[model samples]
Target: MLIKWSKDLEIGVPFVDADHKVLINLLNQVDDCITEQEETTVLGSVLEALVSYTEYHFTREEKLMELAGYPSIDEHKNVHQKLFHKVRAIYHSFAADRESVQVDDVRSFLQSWLTSHILVEDVKYRSTCIDKSEAAKQAGMVPFINTNGTHVPFNEWGFLRVLLVDDNPNFGKLVSTILKAVGISNIEVTQTPSEGLALMSRRPADVVLCDWVMDEMSGTQFAAKMGEMEIPSKIVMLTGYSIDTLQTKVSSPNISAYLEKPINAHNLLDTITRTAFNG
Candidate 1:
C-alpha cells in the first residue's frame, strides 16, 4: 500500500511537518524493501535506519514540546517509551527469525498505528496551540498616535482569544467557562479542527488550546496545517501521555504552550493569560 501526504494531514507547523515527511518517507522505504524480499543485509540496514531516525525524530519533537511548556509531557513520554520498547522487541524477533517477520505485517502495523495516531491524536494538539497563539496576537496588538500624530505601534497588554478544540463537547464547554471565570471572555469552543479553522479564517484568534489526541487528527498535524496557512496564532498542546514521547513530535513556533490533561483551572488560566498578554 502506498502512503501519501495530503493537505488533510498537515498541521501547519513547518519544522514538525518536515520531520513528519521524513518519517513517512522512511517508513515507506522500509515497506518497499520488505516487499522486494531483500536480503538480510539490506533489511538490517533499513531496520537500523528506521530505529535511528525514530530516536532522533522523537528527541527533537519532545524537546520542542517541552520548550513550549507542554503539560502532559510525562504521559506522552511514556507512550514513546512503550513504542520504542516494542520496536526493539520487534527488531530482535525479526533478526532472530527473519522468516517470521513479513513485510505485510510491519506495514500493516505501522500504517494503522501512524494513521490513527497522526490523524486523530496529533491533530488535536495542533488545533489547541494555534487557537492560543492567535488569541495572544489579537490581545497584543495596540496602536497609538506618534509624536507627529501619525498612528504608530505601541506595546499593549496582550490578551488571548482562546479557541478550545476538543472532541468532548463537555470538556470544551468546561474550558470555555473556566476562561470566562478568569476574565478571559473571548473564547470559542469547537469539536473539530475544521470548525476551529473556519472560525479562525473569519476572525483570527490569539491563541489555541488543543488536546493532543483526538479521533480525526492528531494535535501535531493540526498545528502543522495552521503553520502552513501562515496563521499567527500560538499553540498550546495538551495530552494525558508521558512527556518523553510527547516531546518527540512537538517542536515548533506554532506551539507556544502546553498543558496536561485534567487541566487545572487556575494554572490553565494563568498560563493562558501569561502567554497571551505577556507575549
Candidate 2:
C-alpha cells in the first residue's frame, strides 16, 4: 500500500510540509519497486535516495525548530535520529535478502513509521511554533538567522576511535567502508575476540561495533565481560540474528545499541553518534 500525504501530517511549516511530500512520494516509489519485483540494485538505489532525502529534510526541520526556540527540540531531534536509523536498517536488511522480506512488509513498515511520527510526534511542534510566530508578530521581534550550519558535518566523528569486532573479514571491511564514509578514520578491525580485547586493552575506543557470533566467543559474552571490566567505551552490537535472541543475551548494560546487518552508512553513524555523544 502506498502512503498518501494528508493535511493532518502538516506542522504549519511550509518547507517541512514540502519535504514531507517528497518523502512520501519516495516511499510510494519504494512500494512500487517492491510490487514490480524490481532488481536489487533498483530497490537499493531508491532506499539510498530516501535516506539522503530524509537527512536533508531533518537538517532543515531541526534548524526551523532551533530558530523557533522549541522547548522540546532535543527530544524531537532524538526521535528524528532514531527514525532515520530504523528506516536505514530495514532497507539495508531488505537489500541484503529481498527474497525473505516481502514488499507488503516494507510498505506497511514505512507507512506506520512515517504516519505515526507526523501525527503524534510532529504535531507537538505545530501549536508551539504557531504561537511563537504570533507573539513575535505582536512584539515586532525579528526572525532568527541560521548563522551556524544547520547540517552537522560528518567530520565531527573523526576523533572517535572505533574498534570493529567480527570473525568475517568481508563484514569488517564493509563496516570500515561505512565508517570512513562518515569521516571516522581511526578504526581498528579485529577478526577475533581476543584481538579485539588486546586492542581495547592497549587503547580504548570511543565506540566499539561488535558482531554477535564470533569464533572464540560471542559478541554478547564480550559485551558482558567488558561490563565486568567497566570499560568506558560504548559498545554497539552488529548482528543479523534474531533480535529476540539478541535481547535475551544482552542483559548487561554494556551494549549501547543493537543494529541489524547489512548495515548502511546512515544507521551505523547514527548509532555511533547516539551512543558516544548523546550519552
Candidate 3:
C-alpha cells in the first residue's frame, strides 16, 4: 500500500510537514519495491535511507519543540526515541541477515508507523508551538550537531566521556567502537582495571562501562575502590552472567546499571542517558 500524505497530516509547520511528505514518499518507495520483489540489497538501502532521514527529521522536530518551549517535549522525545529504537533494530536485523525479515513485513510496518505518527503524534504539536517559519529560524540558530559527526538521540549527552575497562584488548576496542557508533567520541579505554582507576583519579569519566570478569582487577573490585575514593562517576557493569549471579558478586550502590553482553546499542544509550540524568 502506498503511504500518501494529505492536508490532515500537516502539523501547521511547513518544514516539518514537508519532511513528513518526504518520509511518506520514502515509505511508499519501500512498499513499491517490496511489491515488485526487488533484490534484498535494493530494499536494504531504501530501509537504511529511511532510517537516516527519519532520524534527521526527528532531531529537527525535537529542536523546534524545545525552542518553542512545548509543554510535552519530554514525552514527545520519548515517543520519538522508542520509534527510533524499533526502526534501528529492524534495520540491524536486516543488515545481519536479509532473510531474517521479509521486505513486505517491513513495508507494512513502516506504512502503519508513519501514517499513525504523522496523523496522531505530529498533530499534538500543531497548535502548541510557534509558526514553522519562526521555528525554522530558531532551529537554524542552533543546529544540534554532534561533535563526533554521528547522530545521537540526546543533544545534552554528546559531551559525556566514557571509560571502557576490559582485560581483553579486542573486547575493549569492540566496546569502544560500538560506543563511537552512537556518537560517543570522548572515550578512554584501558585493558587493566588499575589503569582505569588511575585514569579516573586523574580525569574522571562521566560513565564507566567495565567488564565484570577482568583478570588484573575484577569489576567488583574496581567498584569497591571507586567507592572508597568517593569517585562519583556512574558505573555500568558489563557482565556475561545473569543479574542474579552478578548481584551476588558485586552489589555496590555505586554501580548504576548492569548490561548483559553483547551490549545492545539502544540499551547502552538508554542506560547512559538514565545514568547521566540521575547523577
Worst 10 residues of 2 by lDDT: 139-148
lDDT at position 153, candidate 3: 54
Give a tens-digit lDDT track for model 3, residues 1-279.
486667777776666765677677666655655544333444555566567667877988988988787889899999999999988888788769766777667766887898898778778887777465687666544432333333345445568889988775545544454455445788998988998999999888989998898888889999999999888898999876786788778889989999875444445666776776656
**Candidate 2 at residue 221, lDDT?**
88
Q: What is the per-residue lDDT of model 2 for residues 1-279, given as tens digits with 9 covering 90 to 100?
A: 387777778776665675677678667656655655433443565576678667766776676667777789999999999999988887778767777776677778887887798888888878766556543333222211122232234456668799999886545655564565445789999898888887888788999989888879999889877777677788898777666778776756777788876455466666777788777
| lDDT (CA) per prediction | 0.62, 0.71, 0.73
lDDT of 1 by residue, 1-279 (tens): 357887877866555565566557656655655655433433454455455545654565566555556677677677767766766666676668778876677778766655565686557557544435533343223221122332223223124478888886545645654454334667888889888877877777888888788888988888888888887888788776664567776777778778765454445655665566556
Task: Please list the residue runs of candidate 3 whose C-alpha ends up more than 4 Å from where it truly belongs after superposition.
Answer: 35-38, 140-279
**Number of the top candidate by lDDT?**
3
Task: Score candidate 2 by lDDT.
Answer: 0.71
How many residue pairs clash in each candidate at the backbone level? 79, 0, 0
Residue 92's lDDT within candidate 3 is 86
- Candidate 3 clashes: the total is 0
lDDT preference between candidates 1 and 2, better one: 2
Deviation of model 2 at 181, angstroms = 1.7
Q: How close is candidate 1 to the true structure, as a TM-score?
A: 0.44
C-alpha RMSD of candidate 1 = 20.4
Give the candidate order by descending lDDT. Answer: 3, 2, 1
